[model samples]
Target: MKKFNITVNGNQYEVEVEEIKDSSTSAPRIQHQAPVAAPQPSAPTAPKVEAKKPVVTNGAGSVKAPMPGTINDIKVTEGQAVKAGEVLVILEAMKMENEIMSPADGIVKQIAVAKGASVSSGDVLVVVQ
Candidate 1:
């Protein structure tokens, strides 16, 4: 009989083995010690992540444009408190009315275009502080 020790994952285990021989038989008999169960692996976990929207801040503030067509309605006045994505003005572009929303939550600092006026792309229609 022979005894041996094995270590795995910082754990140690002891085992025994035996050998037997018969005079009439050519083959030798072998015996193995009881097997020790291996430790089970833990399941992997998913990482936690957060989703956020993009925001930009400048010295002046946020600026949104009036649509392509004529100004049909102006809903907000200057120095008014407005929330982010608030509709400030409406423009009649391509025979359809479009609402120009505020980019950020702030006070309306300036109004660049007047009611019933025309505007083009990249034009600053209003400023939000």
Candidate 2:
């Protein structure tokens, strides 16, 4: 004879059975169990209200990536003069196109990202002076 532990649904069980020999032996003992329903997790009571907006880094003569994405377009080049609010680059993130704008009127001193380059949030994309 042997003992075994078993689980059905959420309940546990311990059962014993007899071993039968091959020569003119009797039938083996069997056990059956019905499963009980398991406890379900509760759903959230409140839904989310707001999503955080991306950071705008258009100050101190440096422009940074607001989110992780690929550089789809670069509208300004090094040594190019740009006006405040001028669109300097286009970024593709989450299937949306976002324009990175200049914060002040200044000359573009450097462009840190190339077209089709991938950048992470807060990565420097441009320098103005």
Candidate 3:
């Protein structure tokens, strides 16, 4: 018979085993010692992640997502006239709500993203012209 002590996840356990010479022989006996205290786990921490900013391409009057997230709401529609800094879309990222505003005064030429659509950084949300 052999005995061994093991520690896993800050918990201690004792195990015992009996040797068997052949597969045709009887199975080995196993025993366990009294259980030790419950394991103590440290608090988990959130990972540090950098926010990504939207990239402006050659497309004129394009409004892009500043970060990866889901489109929460669209405040404007196609062909709607908008002024610079007016909220055109609402983006939800990292549990926070962000307003995507128009970059210039123009009519909305296109809406690339819809409500509940997932968009990555630099993805076009709307186009005004």
Candidate 4:
């Protein structure tokens, strides 16, 4: 009888075996084998990230967001004349297209949010003068 201990998958196992031989049989042959290990692939590297600064608007006629949403489009450009209640920016919030209208007749002075940009409530969208 022969006893052996083997390790597999971080576990240890004990086993026993019995040997049989016939009187007419020749001597047993011995063979050697080497254990093989599978190759491991390396992990993927993450992309580099950079910090962004907050946008600040200090204009007296700045148009601000009413709710958190993504900017879908800018209807008016800088120096473009706009009327009160005219849609100046398209904001997508709660899966709805929200039209950001001009508060009064004015000219667009500056735009703060870009298309597809996420915005917070009260974030500046455009400056009117």
Candidate 5:
């Protein structure tokens, strides 16, 4: 026999369980036990709110990969004029193609990653200014 303390819906209970090993046809017995003392109420706590840090870049107008992936395609070349939200690179991660977009309207100043190159999260893909 084993004894245990259990809580259900904030109510406390004491329980006893017995193991049956006999192969003969039989039903396990159950006994009702007295309820334990109610637990003390705890002070409620405020939910924790975490502040998100802005993405850090190597330089102004630098675009980086958000996750580890292969550079599937390069949509903009160096010296090309681009607008904010322009897709500059197609990154293949977890079998999905993710478009790397320009963060602001600018001219493509440099290509930091080449097509078919593997990159990690935060790796610079292009620099525009």
Candidate 6:
């Protein structure tokens, strides 16, 4: 028996798993054994998992950073059309390259971190409308 649909942090659990058979059988078997309480399945109305916030669209643009980074240069590509500051990538963090501009001129639509790719602070490098 095995059934598992679990999601933790947004709560959803229906789990049932049973596998126990080792058996050596020394003495006489069959006396009387009754102790079993493990079956809990009643919670599924569905409609909870909603934590989506990545849609940077006011003309959808983003080249975020400001801290925690290591994506040294990725100037633009993917359907490129950006221009509202327009540097678009180059983040090194402590050694400091940190340019990452362009927040609103549109049409790149998605880049989402990948040059050396190690971003953290705000982290969503390039999306541009």
Against the true structure, what is each candidate's TM-score?
Answer: 0.51, 0.56, 0.55, 0.54, 0.55, 0.29
Score each candidate by Cα lDDT: 0.72, 0.82, 0.82, 0.78, 0.86, 0.67
Q: Tens digit of lDDT per residue, candidate 5, span 1-129? A: 889999998789999998778878777688999899877869877889864333345667888888999999999989999987778889999999987788778899999998899999989999989
lDDT per residue (tens digit) for residues 1-129 in model 3: 777778887678877777767779665565658966665669866889875333343468888888899999999989899987788999999999998877778899899887999999988899989
Clashing pairs in 2: none
- What is candidate 2's local distance difference test score? 0.82
What RMSD value applies to candidate 5?
10.8
User: Lowest-scoring 10 consecutive residues by lDDT in candidate 4?
Assistant: 50-59
Residue 107 lDDT (model 6)? 78
Best by lDDT: 5
lDDT string, candidate 2, 1-129, tens digits: 787767666576667777666678565667754444455659745767764333357567889998999999999989999987788899999999998888778899999999999999999999877
Candidate 6 displacement at residue 29 in angstroms: 40
Off by over 4 Å in 3: 1-58
Candidate 5: C-alpha lDDT = 0.86
lDDT of 1 by residue, 57-101 (tens): 334665545346788898899989998767788888888887777
Q: Per-prediction count of colliding residue pairs?
A: 0, 0, 0, 0, 0, 3
* Tens-place lDDT digits, model 4, residues 77-109: 899998877788899999999888887788999
**What's the CA RMSD for each of the models?**
19.4, 12.8, 9.9, 19.4, 10.8, 13.3
Which stretches in model 4 have alpha-carbon errors above 4 Å?
1-59
Better model by lDDT, 3 or 4? 3
Model 6 per-residue lDDT tens digits across residues 1-129: 666666556455666655556665555333322333444569857668854333232333555676786998798888988766667777898886856667567678778777897878776677676
Q: Score candidate 5 by TM-score against the native.
A: 0.55
